[model samples]
Target chain A: MHLERLDFRLQLRALIRKELQQILRDRQLIFLLFAMPILQLFIYGFALSPEVDRLRLGIVDHAGSSISRALAASLVVNGVFEVEESGGTEAQLARKVQDGQLDAGLIIPADLERRYRSGQKTRVQVLIDGVDANTAGIASGYVGQILAAFNRQLTTGTQLPGELVAPQITFAYNPGLISSWFFVPGVIALVLNLVSTLVSSAALVREKDSGTLEQLLMTPVSSLQILLAKIVPLSFLLMITVFVALMVAFLVFHVPFRGNLLLFLFVSFLAILVGISIGIALAAYSENQRQSLLTSFFVNLPVIQLSGAIAPLESMPEIFQWMSLLNPLRYYVSCVRAIILKGVGLEEIWPNVLALAAYALILLSLSSSRFRKQLK
Target chain B: MRRVFSQVTKEIAQFRRDRLTLALAFFLPFVALLLYGYATRLESKNIPVAVKSYDTGTLSRAYIDTLFATNQLVPARFRGSDIMGPLDEGEAKAAIIIPAQFSREVAQGRVADIQVVIDASDVNNARVIKNCVIAAGNYFARSRDIARGRQLIVPQVRLWFNPGRDEALYVAPGAIAVILWIFPCLLAALAMSREKEQGTILQLYVSSITSFELVLGKALAYTLIALAQAVLLIAASMALFGLRLVGDPFMFVLSLVVFLASSVLFGTFAGTRASTQSAAVQLVATTGFTTALLLSGFLYPLRNITYPLSLISNILPARYFVEECRNAFVRGADFASQLYIPLALSSCALFLYLVTSNILRKMQLKG
Candidate 1:
């Protein structure tokens, strides 16, 4: 029994060594393992900001008075709205917006100053393109805020001679509404998913495509040991990437980590497992490297959408909401958001934890079984 | 010429036999289009909100009525002081706290503030909610002003092209760019790398086939397939997502052909450098995928991005394509208006194809 155990240990060491040598030899793989994560970190950290600013505004001022000009000037003061073109006809302004040259148009009626002075309400029109639903919605909101502030200025000290209602707004958690803070958590989920998914499948299928996998199978290692050997090196590389991503999130983006460190680590590992399992399952089913790649794209596109990465779970259509329940990314994304942003513990995020665990279990088992069958 | 024709024919036959590659080439673009179209909805409507009204007064009721009427907020009753319970459970995104003195203060013409506590976990969603809440408050305040026989300045908002502010218009064409980018590039990158990895590239080198003929043959075959996919995606976007082709159809097709040629040329460049399928895949994913997602201005406007990122955006072909698509689809801009973009695109295509062919021919001379 002791000799047999010793023999098993020896075989395991050889398998691991072989895997490591292969990984180190491929300069491209090493680059994928290191440079890709760091590049993505910088890309997402610097490039993508959810905060909408500097929207192009078209103006048509038929009022031709100080009040109408003041409104336009006030809208531009916040730096969120930039006046692209001024003093155009309303139809011309609308055409500019339709042509995608401008995002929004403001139309001040001809009788605006006359009506305001005569104790009659005058409506000023603000038209915005809604093609980009998020930007459109936010632009409209910014317009509202600008209007409310303008109304307050009209009512406050210089005194418009009329009372206006103003809402006292308090933004909980992130008061500044920093786009990076929101993105950091999603970025963590995304970087980890991309690394784990691409690396695990690519590493496994590379061996098969090169015929090294068959030779490795001929050795004393069990099918499970070979599978474990295949994943362990790649997963370790992926874990290093996770650390890199976290460092970038904390140090560069300055995303706050209010939750327990240990819990965050634990949940992240669960997310990594989820990525690896799905990748391996796809790899096992695919006959070649290219097929596996196409499969990965097919799976990843849906996974990203269902994960509530960009489109919130609350916003997706009803059937898609149901589909999101099965997406591991959904649970991981929500869990990380809750942990990082809300600083909630496992008690609050248990559903996501349970779902992630379930995904790992089912995917790991399914892929391993398929792998074993193929080996036989 | 004969060698090139025979090589092209061989490539066409191989492509047909590869069922998986063919399916991915012909079918995946539509699938990706449908998925992205259905998934990306930017309009923030029907936000679940908790109404914590302490005052049972007509003014407070009016405020609540105005909030619901905007169609932005969907009110759910907050059970007493446990407002955080609904918010923590993700049932409500925001809570409107009307203090007990709300009616009294409003009635007496005093500044009565409605406390809007927002869960700003998602910055994008939070902005939408905050704006809606403020708009609702302003609407109520205006009603009060009119009640007192005062003049108010109201703003009327209008949206054009995508008047309904449908996200499909924003996402569908962008999705087409993404789909075209991935499949065609991968197909071309893998075409040559597959030869190398299978040791068939050595056989081609040994045979009488010149390097120019080989590169042109593969490029032509893949370009035709990619062009077909592009057309399918364009048609699918129109039929399903209502993408209006308002510009010159001829110019649109010309721009597409130019864009596809540039992409395939870049793919050939990557394929020639990489000796294995895995390396080629890695190269394409890192360079192609990352550039498309990051530098293409697909997700956000190029102008708002910082100096370095904006500079990077200039080098990527997808940025120009996305811009041209928006102009064509929305503004119906003529060829003269977008002349420089296609010109730049075709020049890049010509340059890359020349470089790739030169490199391959040099290798042929060496062998």
Candidate 2:
């Protein structure tokens, strides 16, 4: 029995060494496994922001009064809108907007200063290109706020009752509201998913396509042992990716790591396990590398979308909100965000941790069972 | 030309035999359309805000009522005086604390201050929350003033193009662009690399088919497949999201054809460069998928992308295609005004085709 155990150890070690060598020898795979994640990290961190700014504005100041100029000036002062054209008819402004030269046009009427001086309510027309709905909504909101503030300034000290209620806003966790702090954690989850699932499934499918799995099965190693060997090395490599990504998030993006380091690593390890199991299940279901890749893409896209990695969960409809509960990546993202940004402990993130652990266990068991059956 | 046609027929035969690829080619785009249309809501709603009021006065209650009236910020329940509890526990995205004597101060004609603490971990959501809270406050004050019968300057806002702010109208066109680019590029790349991976390119090297004919053959087959994909996705968008062709269909169709050809040829180029199917797919995924999704102005506007990155976006075919699609579906601009998009698309297609053929010729010479 002692000799048998020793032999088992020897076989497992050999299998792991072989897997490592195969992975390391592929220069392209190594680049993809390591460099791509960092590259994507920087690109997404810098490029992706929902904050709307620098919209092109066209002003048709028919009034040509100081108030009209001040109103138009206020819009550009905040840098939300840039004055692209200041002197044009409303028709010309509309034409420019249609030609995609301007994002919005503000028309000040001819009687603007006269109406205001006479204490009669004045009306100004603001035409916004609403093809991009989100930007238009935000721009309109800005216009509303600016107009309200302008009204207050116009009516000040004239028995116009002051605002009875005011809100003092304070942003917690990230005082500056850095977008990268939010995106980096999500990117970490994304990178982990890509490496663990795509690479592992491709590795396995490539073996099956080359008929190496059958040859390996001809040996004395158990199917479970072979699977373990493949998973162990892949998980080690994925951990390195997670580490490098975390470093980039810290050094480059200045993403604060507030939670316990050990806890973050543990959660990431579970996430990697979940990813590898998903890849294994995909490999078991596909006949070739192409099919596996296509299937993975089909599966990964929805999972990533529903995970709230890019889009927020509260904004989704109720059904999808509930459906996101089933996605394991959701838990990973929540845990990472809570740990890194909120600096919450296991006590706060226990539910997410439990969910991730359950997913890792269940998926690993189901995929390994299917894989073992296929091997037999 | 006849050799290219026969090669196309051979490639189609191979494509049809792969039932999974065939199903994926048709089904994946449909799924992506559904997901992007329904699941992605840039307009944030139903943000949970914990409202902790220290006063039980009618004015404070009315203020709280007005806050939740918009339904943009929903009230979250919390048990304690700790305003930060719900935020830390992730139960609420923000917290509103109404100080004591708030209603009295307002009744005494002094301004009442309400403290709002927001979790800015998600910066965009935090910004939305801040705006919602402030808007609610402004609404409260404005309504009070209106009750008192005061005149105010009103801005008549007109939302042109998409007056209803229908998110699907904005999202669907971008989705179609991204879906078309990713799948065709992926399919073409895989098809190109599969021959090299299996050592079947050697046969082509020995055959009488010129390198141009071979590349043209593969490009034609995949473009045909992508054309079908484009039709199915556009139809699905129309049915699912109530998307309609708002302008002349000529520019949209012409640009779409060139766009698909360019994407497929781009894939073919990547396939020529990468020696294996996985490598080609990876190449497409990392470059093709990422750029098409991010830089193509799919979710965020092109203006949001800063310099250097914006420069990269200028070269991406998906960016121009997305612009043309948005114009076709939403803006309904004139055909002459939108002519530059198709021209840009054709130039991209020509460049990709030339590069792909050149690479194929080089491979033949080496062989």
Candidate 3:
């Protein structure tokens, strides 16, 4: 058997050309690669609003007086609660909440107004559905605010024999709590991670499964050449898709790019490298396309979960917090949020930037070595 | 019956060969549940705050102490005239400013202003901090009111089904249902599509067994495997997260069987529609799991969502199953109370089975 010397430039070019041809021919996948980001961007953008408005509130007003009616009106005044039914029993309200008709319900004592008139301590009950705990917690907070405001009004122009500590609130960065400001950067990182991983892994795993890798092996092209060919076009395609996703974030969500454009692009390039490496590594590990896809799903979700996009890292257990340090998505999310929201530069976000670079380098080398071993 | 039995043995044999797929089906849920269990918690406790106290009097100190007592906000480092500086730098999420007149104003029964500067870049955290600040102020006022022989209007918040609002308790049950739905569906979704891509479908056509037999055999094998996965997940949930079967044991198991059967059937249905194994894989990963996660009202309340979107959630079988699981495990609901969801799930499963079997038969006849 005679072995010819490897020609790096010629072999890589041919392999890349072949991969690009395959990508272009697979119209369904190309469409999926582009369309999935835009679809998810719109779906998550509109669907995921943290600002809880118009909660269904059932009122049980046993007081039956002007004061009680005024309290109920105050609850419904700010478009926070649309009054479902007034003057219902607590049992009726519980039934309504249990049956999914009302998200929450309020019960007023029979002597609420009388107690207010007589200068005695009184209480009002707010029952929240605990099924969706996040919404329930927020709704409970809103109820607190509503009641505090009512308490002030209830004692207005009258003397209260105690210290009244008034709290003045000031919100920075986003005063109105526009959820899009929070979601846009997160969606960008998530979309880039997803599209790049799926496309890159599918690219290589398809070749391996279809016996095309054997055809490439018949040539002088080495395993390294084949791996580069697989990653390069997908990385370039990922860059274009990410650029389009950033355009959506800017135009549709109106999230401004506050930091240096070059810095942002450089950081995105690092993130895309991380994504492609995971994809290639997952592809190298699996025998076929089905295995690769399932393995990638297992890998991607944990990366996102530990990334602190949806929840704060501080809130998580100490061990998961440590585990998040290894997650490339965590640094990507942190850097993007800092650049867009805080308008911080490289000096402020160098650690995260370095982390992304380190992750890309480490993951790329590991996956390349694994791919070479699989080739053997 | 013998044909079906042989098919089951063949599937189990194939399943044994692929240790990776077997490990994924058996164990990915445990990892996913652990990650999501810690990751999806929305409660913002131990949030750092900066205190700029212009009033070092006893009243001001007491007020700051009251804020700390909630255990929601902890004091962090802050040094600057502008409170926004530290907040923008991410040193602290909130800052409290106690005015010099705090002691005097409170002593005279006058309204005293204590400013809380919140970084609202994270809206959820901001809202939680704002509420905590308000509650702290109210507690201070109510304590003083009781001392001064004054009346206070106390507000009681009662949370049903989940009293203490433990995040793990809320996430575990839903995570189990999602795990049961996703893993088996993925494995079964691939069975038919893999055969098509590998030309085994042609081999099946040349054989004497009918397409109904093939589809039925595949479904039965996977249904058994999924049932095993269900048991593993339930045990994991209980052992790891302290999830208990508060309702009838038989009813919960029944619900689990129904949900598992329907999910695998749905996967089989998706397989028939897909032309390639990759497409079916994508269907399981992106479409099936995402539909179950987002549309099932697992994380968010369905009632709060508006008309058309709410209507769309009704069509997803996972929605009913998640509700059923929560009802059985958390609410301790009985069979009589939860009859409708099981019936609905069974109908969906039967519908998908009939559709998939028909498609398989049609493909066989054409071949």
Pick by TM-score: which candidate is best? Answer: 2
lDDT of 2 by residue, B174-219 (tens): 9999999999998899899999998999899888888989999999
Per-candidate TM equals 0.92, 0.97, 0.91
Writing each residue's lDDT as its tens digit, candidate 3 over B246-267 gives 7767777777777888888988
* Candidate 2 vs 3: which has more lDDT: 2
Candidate number that wins on lDDT, 1 or 2:
2
> Each prediction's DockQ?
0.56, 0.69, 0.51
Model 1 chain A worst lDDT window (10 residues): A155-164
- Indicate the TM-score of model 3: 0.91
* TM-score of candidate 2 against the unseen true structure: 0.97
The parts of candidate 1 lying over 4 Å away from their true place are A1-14, A86-95, A107-116, A120-125, A151-165, B1-4, B76-85, B147-152, B202-213
DockQ of 1: 0.56
DockQ of 3: 0.51
Runs in model 3 with CA error above 4 Å? A1-15, A85-88, A95-101, A159-163, A217-224, A373-376, B1-9, B79-81, B99-110, B144-152, B206-213, B248-251, B304-308, B334-337
Colliding residue pairs in candidate 1: A124-B154, A124-B155, A124-B156, A125-B156, A126-B156, A126-B157, A126-B158, A127-B158, A130-B165, A133-B42
In candidate 1 the C-alpha lDDT for residue B17 amounts to 92
Candidate 2 segments exceeding 4 Å error:
A159-162, B79-81, B146-151, B365-367
